[model samples]
Target: MTGKFIVIEGLEGAGKTTAINTVARILNQHNIDDLQFTREPGGTPIAEALRHIIKNGLDNEPLTDKAELLMLYAARIQLIDNVIKPALKAGKWVIGDRHDLSTQAYQGGGRQLDKTFMVTLKEQVLGNFKPDLTLYLDIDPEIGLMRARTRGELDRIEQQSLPFFERVRQCYLEIAKQDRTIITIDAGKSIDDVTKQIEQILTKWLTKQV
Candidate 1:
């Protein structure tokens, strides 16, 4: 079988790291072990540099939302051409921490960028390229931010207001609803429960793949 690209997505503190681990474990259990892991805006070297700017800001130079969105796409295409696409061609299952959905949610929703521009950019750069499956962990922004706060420092995007995150979540939900390839998970539950849900989802998905 050819490689499948699976993405884990959520707002900050939605427990994506754990969900990624769970997905890997379940895939391994199914003997689908040739896995290539990637994180959005940072997989390739060029992408990583852009990621640093996106997260930490470059010398406190104010980053325009439109520029930030463009940087993310630049980093994304770099990773796709340099890392993800090659890995997939070699029969390695690509697991992503985030993908274009992030731009759709964060930039389009949170930053309120132009939807037409977002769509145009996505089509021009990505075309139809997308994850085979997406696991979205949904959580309350208030709770999510609290969890993020305990993790030390908040990044540039993480420092947004509650309403901003709420809009992001809303956008995520709206997109998820329109896409059956995307699975929504209630991340507000315990970690154990969340892991179990992922295992079940992957097991079923793998079965259908056969």
Candidate 2:
């Protein structure tokens, strides 16, 4: 049987790294050990290069919002073609740091890009491709940014204003409400509590797949 693609998404400091680990551990507990991990705008040589530029702008060059959005999709397509699709075909479950939902939130909502354009671009690039499951760890932007500040310097995207991240979070919630596959959890809780939530959600979802 083909494997599933599960994505973890949220604002910076939303504990995505820990959540990914929890998902992996739970999958292992279920005897699903063939796991392939990946991150957005990455997972391939080409995508990594794009990731670098996206994370840290090329020198002092101004990265336009439209360009940034396009680059993200470009990196995503490369990763999907070279890594994710192949892993799924091989029956190895693909665990991702972020996915298309990120663009819908970050670029579409945060950047305030035209909805028509965003929809058109998404269709043109990804078609019907999407994660089988998405776990969005939600937290207030103020608290999340404070946590992010402790992690050293912020990246280009991470350096956006608080209002920008607020928009991103709003978009995340709006979409999560509309999509059954996307699960939203309050990440402000303790790690153990968050892990319990993830385990419960994943275990129930996994049972249905079987």
Candidate 3:
């Protein structure tokens, strides 16, 4: 049997890494031991190199919007084909830190790109591929940015304007509304509270799956 794919998505400093750990623990409690964890634009060696380029801007030339989009897709397809798909086929659950929705929110909404073109690109690259469940941790952009700043200097994409992130947040919410498989969580809450909510949600879903 093919295993499930669970994706955790949010803006920078949305506590996605911690949330992933929480999800893994929940899955373990349910005896789903075989698992794989991945992050995009990374997982495979080539994808990691792409991730470095995407996050760290060039000194002289800025990365073009279209180029960034293509790079993200390139990394995504590489991880999916080389790692995620094979693991699922072997009945290992895959948990991802981010996925295609990041592109939809950042490139489509943040960058204000052409939506139709984005859809065409997605279909061409991914076809019907999608996560079985997506937990979208929603937080105010200001709060998220503040948290991110404390860690270190912002990355290329992270240095975008406040308005950009507002659009990204709006896009995320809109997409979550349209997709029944996606669950929205208020990440503004305390970490303990967020983890509790995640556990509750996953427990209910897992029960149904059984």
Candidate 4:
């Protein structure tokens, strides 16, 4: 059986991890085998090390916009080649916490990176492995930051200023507008409500697409 690749996208603290976990439970309930869940920039060993450099600090005091964008693509290529594509090929339902949208939002949106550069990199690096379904969790940046703050220590990216998050959210909206494969979900709702909505959406998609 062919597999469905479902990717969950959102700004920082948009409850994406919760949604991913919920989707995993839903798929497991249906006896779906080989269900694979992963996050960008960290799916494989080498990519994970890169993620650490991006998320934490490895050597540089400040990372340039171009470097940030390039690193994201590098991690993406590694993830797609090593983990995501293979899982789909083996008939596994793949649920990803985040994917290319993060690059568009973080690099293109947040950092004001070059749009043409991103497009070119995506074409050259990603080729044809786009997600079958991309779920975008929408939430206000302020609310998201508060939620993240309540969790624990903030990472480098998470500690970014409000303006940065605003840019990221706007980019996400633009992405949703441009990509028909993406579905937007309000992330401000209670956990149960958000899960219910996701379940309904996934159930509907599975019923029709599968």
Worst 10 residues of 4 by lDDT: 56-65
What is candidate 3's lDDT per residue for 1-210, written digit by digit as tens? Answer: 259999999998899999999999999999999999999999999999999999996675788999999999999999999999999999999999999999999999999889999999999999999999999999999999999999999988999999999999999999999999999999999999999999999999998887
Query: What digit string (tens of lDDT, one per residue) describes model 2 on residues 1-210?
Result: 469999999999999999999999999999999999999989899899999999999989999999999999999999999999999999999999999999999998899999999999999999999999999999999999999999999999999999999999999999999999999999999999999999999999999998
Candidate 4, 76: how far from true, in Å?
1.1
Candidate 1 lDDT tens digits, 29-140: 8898999999998988889999999999987799999999999999999999999999999999999999999899999989999999999999999999999999999999
Per-prediction TM-score, please? 0.99, 0.98, 0.98, 0.96
TM-score pick, better of 1 and 4? 1
lDDT winner between candidates 1 and 4: 1
Q: How many backbone clashes does candidate 3 have?
A: 0
RMSD of each: 0.6, 0.7, 0.9, 1.2
TM-score of 3: 0.98
Preferred candidate (TM-score higher): 1 or 3: 1
lDDT of 1: 0.94
Per-residue lDDT of 189 in model 4: 90
